[model samples]
Target: MAQWLAAQPKTIVVQPTTLCPMDCTYCYLLERHLKQEMTPQVASAVADGIGPSWEPVEVVWHGGEPLAVGLTRFVELLQPFESLRQARRVRHKVQTGGGRPITDAWCDVFEQYEIGVGVSIDGPRELNHHRVDRGGRPMFDRTIAGIETLKRRCIPFTVLAVVSQDGTGQAAQVLDFMRDLGTSWVGFNIEAKEGANSDGQTPSIDHARQFWRDTFEWCRRNNDVTVREVSNLLGFLGLTQERRDADSQHDPIPTIAWNGDVVLLSPELLGVRSVTYDDFVAGNVLEDDLSAIVQRSDELLYVQEFTNALETCKQTCEFFSFCQGAHAGDRFFEHGTFAVTETDHCRNSVQAPVLALAELLQAKGSR
Candidate 1:
């Protein structure tokens, strides 16, 4: 627990605004309708809270749709980090829905800041129908147009696709679609029940396991576009086999809400309200130092319970070394508590991929 408190967050997720153009069915942001934007004061407080770090820190501009704040207002929000950026101590990244609103000015800002952009497009039209506009219209064409704009401007960006049950079976198609869009990197996020969307359906453990296996095989053959999940699993498994102390180090990741409220660990825990813990909010950047907030959160009962669960996992679970107890938000949402280990999320996301990759290696050895 001391090490956890001492660990400085490498990334700070900043939600600029709750407003969004599209209404993805499985979105975790329950308050997406609210037009609330993070105040400049709040932004300044976040900048001050983070202060100086020895290593480069990433400020991820995330939201219902970060671009929904518009290009001009977005630049204004980034003003507080300019000094840090100039010093090469901090960098900016944005996770956007890649709707119809992207403009040349946005690309200029991206180039100026060297923002690592990640566009959220769930493959082609058939797969992306779930991520629709407010009027329930598919945004595939508009999203692709935004991707084209980024490409034309010579901006390298990553694609993040949310895999639903409907789209999980089409691994080859998803791979081809992403490659055709000219993205060098693709990350898949499985739909989970969280925040306001408790009814969201996750593919069955078996289905998800098969999907990952198929996806990994396809990516292995293609070798051009990087599949984030498969690559990460392979890296962790391949590297950590010789290192015993890998699971002991836990880095805190702070998520700053529109109002300056900070939540440690999973960013998905920020906006979510729970009967047991209220809202997992450690503290506010305006009122407390980041170090103080993290220390205080260590005293929280839920945090303690989550820590205990992770310790148990370290002792009990075979994949604990690679996964490091997995994401707390998923545990709370799926199993109603963090004291438990191995949810369906774990099976599909971590365990299944690991098993699949190992089997592939075994087959190669036999051959």
Candidate 2:
């Protein structure tokens, strides 16, 4: 058990800049860029805080649009961390919106330093309307061009698509677009109903549920490519035979924002407001000791509350153990508590999937 724990390395997320050019409706970070550039001193401090101990650290550059910092300044920020990566202490990654053009020089930096890259795009032309520029013009062409550049250069990347009401009805079309893009893997993230655009345009929970069902069935029928949303579901379906103990190395998945704040579990948690903390950031890795902050974060208090809710759920819901409670941000946004489950997630992410699977089983039995 101890050996298993030792094998996993800690992950560090570094946000070099948060200046974003695009103005997506659902982007919570749109209001977060009051100030969004990191100094050399802060970047160096981040490098020193993580230190040489955490054997396999992953530094993820996430931002309003990570590449908005420009390729030159980005290189300056990465130079210090790149040296550490070369020494076998850390891994690197960058997440971008792909709304901007990519340069050969940028690709060279990515090829030289990171293990993988992730881009945000809904799908082909028609499905990506909501992610437009400030002038209300569709930027899908530019995004597609950026993706083509990556594919042309053989740079390994993943596409993250937000499944919305429109997307739900057009899962097949979205999948077709992905297949054409030659996307090796795709993550179909559900649009959160509580953030920037939630007030006027949140998708119905029923629509979300249908979308998950349709998307999952699509993945099962077309098994040639990797679909991350279905992969997670399959794990829940007991389809995978592999089993291991809990002592396995559990690296802290860090999501560092442009201002140096660290969020746990997922990067999506950043800017997600909580009732108690009102802010999701546990600490700034550059200014605070990473280990100490992780230990003392107010974020954990919310996690504990959520865990307590799960315990209560197990007593009531038959599928409690198999379910993922609402994402912390969603819970806080909808219910005003991290401990409670949002009706949307319960209906969409959990209840809907379970019921759909049950119906399929019953129909098969009757036949």
Candidate maximizing TM-score: 1
- The global C-alpha lDDT for each of the candidates, from Candidate 1 onward, is 0.82, 0.67
Task: Report the C-alpha lDDT of model 2 over 1-367, residue by residue, as the tens digit.
Answer: 2221122337666766666777777776634444477777667767766644566677777776878788878877887776788887877778888756876777898888765788888987888887888687888988888878888899978888887677878877788788888777888766665655555344676676677667767776886557775675567676333331111232446666766777764455666674676566778866796666655543376655655564565556665545534355566556666566545656666666666666666867999
Tens digits of per-residue lDDT, candidate 1, 1-367, equal 7643336767889999988878888888878888889988889888877745436788999987899887778888899989988988889999999653667899999999889999999887888877888899988888878888888999999989988888778888999988988989998887778776679888887777777878988988898899988888767656745574565555567889899898877787867788888888888988988656765777676677778888888889998877877777788888778789888788888887888777778988999
For every candidate in turn, the CA RMSD to the true structure comes to 1.7, 3.9
Error of 1 at 176 (Å): 1.2
Reference-based lDDT, residue 177, model 2: 82
Candidate 1 least-lDDT 10 residues: 240-249
The backbone clash count of each candidate, in order, is 0, 0
Candidate 1 lDDT at 178 equals: 88
